[model samples]
Target: MKKLLVLALVVLIAMVSFAKEQILHIYTALDENEWPIYVKAFEQATGIKVQVVRMSSGELLARVEAESKNPQASVWFGGPAIDQIAAKKKGLLAPYRSEAVEKVPAAFKDPDGYWIGIYFGAIAFGSNKEQLKQLGVEAPTSWYDLLKPQFKGRISLAYPYTSGTSYTVLAALVAIMGEDKAFDYWKQLHKQIHHYNTSGSACVTQAGLGEITVGIAFAHDIITKGIDKGYPIVLTFPKEPTGYEIGAMSMIKGAPEPDLAAKFIDWMLSAEAQSLMVKWNRIPINPEAPVAPGAVKMQDVNIVPMDFEYFGAEKDRLIERWKEEIEYGM
Candidate 1:
C-alpha cells in the first residue's frame, strides 16, 4: 500500500513538471485577427504552450515600461519594430543572438541582437472601392491625392502621440521628405482627415465598413481582413515611395525562461515561421519564405529609404511636432 501511494505521488509531480515546461508567455500588440494564426503554429512546431496577451501598441509599451522593475513576459512579439527599438534604448530588452537570424537581412534585424524582424508591412491607403465610386471620388494613388478636397472628412488615421502605426507613418514621411517637408505635408493632409483614432488597426476596419472612404494603416491589416471577411478594400502605396514597418520579436530583459525565450526567438525568425505569416497576409522579411499569392511583396514596391536608427533617435521630437502642428492644430 505504501509503495503504490509513493508511485502515484511521483507520477503527479512528473505530469505537473511536464505541463510547466510546455507553457510560455508572449506579449504582443497583434489583435485577435493575428494571434490565433501564430499561437496555433507556434504550438504545433515546438509543442510550447503559448499564453498570449494582446494589447495596443501604446498599451504594450506602457506595460513593458511598467513591468521593467520585474518583467513578466518571456518574449515580446509582433509590435512595431520602432517600439522595440525604443524599448532597447531603455534597457527593457535583452540581447539575443539567434542562429535563425542569419536568414534575415542586416537592415531588418537589430545590429546588437535586441530584436529580429519577422515580417514587413507598409503604411498605405486602404480605400473602400465601392464607397469611393459611390461618392464619385477616384481612388487615391498618392499622398497628395489624400489631401484633395474630395477626401475631406473622408479619411481615417491613428493619432501619432499614441499609436506606433501613426508614428511609423510619421517617421517614414520624415525619412522620405525630410522633417520640414513631412510636417508641411501632414499639416496640409490634416484638412482631409476625418479624425485621429486611438487604435491603428481600427482605421483599416473603419475603411472596410465605409465609415471613411480612405484609411491610412498597415497594408497587411487591410489586406488580411478584406481577404478573410470579403470587404471590398483596395490597398495601395504612393508612387513616390512610403515607409514600411519591420514587425519584430525580442526577448524581455531577465526573462524567467531564458533558454526557452531564446529558442522561441530562433523559431520565430525561421523560414518556417516566416511561411506561417502568409496566413496573416503579411510579407515575410526572410528571403526564403515564399510570398503569399496576391500579397504585395516589398521587392516589387518603391519603398522610401528609411533610417530606422535615426527615426528611433528622433521619435520624441517628431511626436512633439505632430502634436503641435496636427493634434493641437497649431
Candidate 2:
C-alpha cells in the first residue's frame, strides 16, 4: 500500500511537470530585434506560447551542453548551421523529418534530419560614411583595403569564440587564404581593431552610428539594420570569395514538449514564416519564399565553397587557435 501511494505521488509530480512545460521553451541565437517577429507569428498561428533564451551560437551551444543531462528547451532556432552540425555530433538534437522542410535544398539541411536551414547570408564590410569621409577613404571595395595604414584601429569585428557570424568569416578566410595564411591575415587585421564585440551585430550597429569606420558583418544585416535604416552606413563586399552562413534550426534531444516542438519547426519552415523574414532582408532557404528586395544575390558575389562537414568538425580546434594566436596572442 505504501509503494502504491508513493507511485501515485510520483505520477502526479510528473503530470504537473508536463503541464508546466506545455508552454514551449526554446534556445535561440536570433538577433534581439529579430526573434520577436517570428515568435509573434508562431503564437498567433498555433496558440502555443514560447519561452526564449537568446544568446549567440557559441554561448547557446555551451548552455545546451551544460543542460544536456536535464534538457531545458524544446528547440534551438536561428544560428549558423555549422554550430548545429557540431551539436548533432554530440547527440544533443532530436531528428524529426517535417514535410515543410521537404523542398529545402540538400545543401541547407542534414540528410538525416538533424537540422534545417532557415536562411543564408554573405559577409560584407559595413562602412560608416561620415567616419570614412573624415579619414578621406571611400568604402573599401576589397578585403585588403581595410588593411590600409589609414584604417588602423578603426575596424571592428566580433570575437570568433563567441560569435558564430565571426566564426563564419574566419572559416571563409581559411577557405580563401589557406589555413596558415588566414591566421596571418587575421593577425594583421587584428592590429586594426577597435576592440572586438561579443555580439556579432553590435559591431555593425557601432558602424551604423559612426562609432567606428567599418565593421565586418553579414550583408543582409548591413542592408536591413544599417544601410536601409537611414544610418550613415554603406555595405561593400570583398572582391574575392567570402563566407556565408546557413542559418539553421533544430529540435532538442529531450524536449518536454516534443509534439509542440515538432509543430513549431514545421510552422517555421512553412512558406508563411519564410516569407516574413524578407522584411528584415534575410533570403529564406524555402524555395517557395521570396527573396528580400535588396538581398544580395549569391551569383553576383564570389562566394567560397563552404565545406560544412570539415568546418563543423574543425570549429573547436580553429577557435582554440584563434584565441591563442589572434585574440590573446600566442
Candidate 3:
C-alpha cells in the first residue's frame, strides 16, 4: 500500500509539472501596441497560453546572452532578422526547420533555420506637416535632403547600438553609398539630429507629436502609429534607395518547452498568422498572405539589397566605429 501511494504521488507531480510548462515564454522586440494582437490570436488558435518579455533589439540580444546557461524564453518572437543572425552567430539559437518554413523565401530566412521571417517593412521619413512648415521646410524626398540648413537639429532616430531600425538605416546607407561616403554623409547629417531615441518607434511618434520635424523610421510605424492615429504626419522615402527589415522569429537554444515553441513558430508562418500583421501595417513575407493596404512593399520604394549575413556579422564592429567617428549632436 505504501509503495502504491508513492508511485501515485510521483505521477501526479509529473503531470503538474507538465501543466505548468504548457505556457510558451517568448522574448520579443515587436512593437508594444502590436504584440497583443498577434499573441491573442495565437493563443486562441493553439489553445496554449503565452508569456512575453518585451525588450528593444539590443536589450533582447543582451538578455539572451546573459541567460545562455539557463534560457528564460523558448522563442524570440519579432525584431529585425539581423538580430536573429547575430544570435545565431553566438550559438544562442536552435536550428528549427519545418514544412511551414517553406512559405518564407531564402532571402528572408536563415538557411539553417536559426531564424525565419514573418513580415517586412522599409525605412522611411516621417514628417509632421505642421512641424515642417513651422521650420519653413517641406518634407524631405531624399536622404541627402535631410542635411538642409533649415532642418538643423530637427531630426531624430534611435541610436544604432540599441535599436535594430536605426542599424538598418546605417546598413542601408552603407549599401547605397560606399562605406567611406556613407561615413562622410553621416558626419554632416549628425548635426541635423536633435536627439537619439532608444526605442525604434519613438522617433516616429516624436515626429508625429511635433517634437521633431522628421523621424527616420520604418514605414509601417509612420502610417499605423503616426498618420492613421491623426498625427498630421506624411510619409516619404529616400530617392537614393534605402533598406528594409525582415521581422524574424527563432527558437531559443535549449528552450524549456520546445514542442510548444515549435507549434508557435509553425503557426506564425502560416497564412493565418501572417494575415494578422496586415492590420498592424507589416507586409507579410508569405506570398500567399494578404498585403496591408498602402503598406510599403519592396518594389514600392527605392531600396538596395542589404546583405543580411554580412551586416549581422559586422554589427558589433560597425557600431563601435560609429561611436568613434560620429560626435554626439554635431
Q: lDDT of all the models against the reference?
A: 0.82, 0.89, 0.89
Query: RMSD in Å for candidate 1, one decimal?
Result: 2.8
Query: Candidate 3: which pairs clash?
Result: none
Q: What's model 2's lDDT at 64? A: 89
Give the lDDT of residue 102 in candidate 3: 79
In the range 74-142, model 2's lDDT, one tens digit per residue, is 899998998888888888999999998778988999999999999988999999988888899889888
Q: What is the lDDT of candidate 2?
A: 0.89
Question: Can you give the lDDT of residue 182 in candidate 1?
Answer: 92
Off by over 4 Å in 2: 1-21
TM-score for every candidate vs. truth?
A: 0.91, 0.93, 0.95
Candidate 3 at 223: error in angstroms? 0.6
**lDDT for model 1, on a 0 to 1 scale?**
0.82
Give per-residue CA lDDT, model 1, range 237-289, as digits (tens): 88888888888889999787777788778877777877888887788887788
C-alpha RMSD values across all candidates:
2.8, 3.5, 1.8
A best-first ranking of the candidates according to their TM-score comes to 3, 2, 1
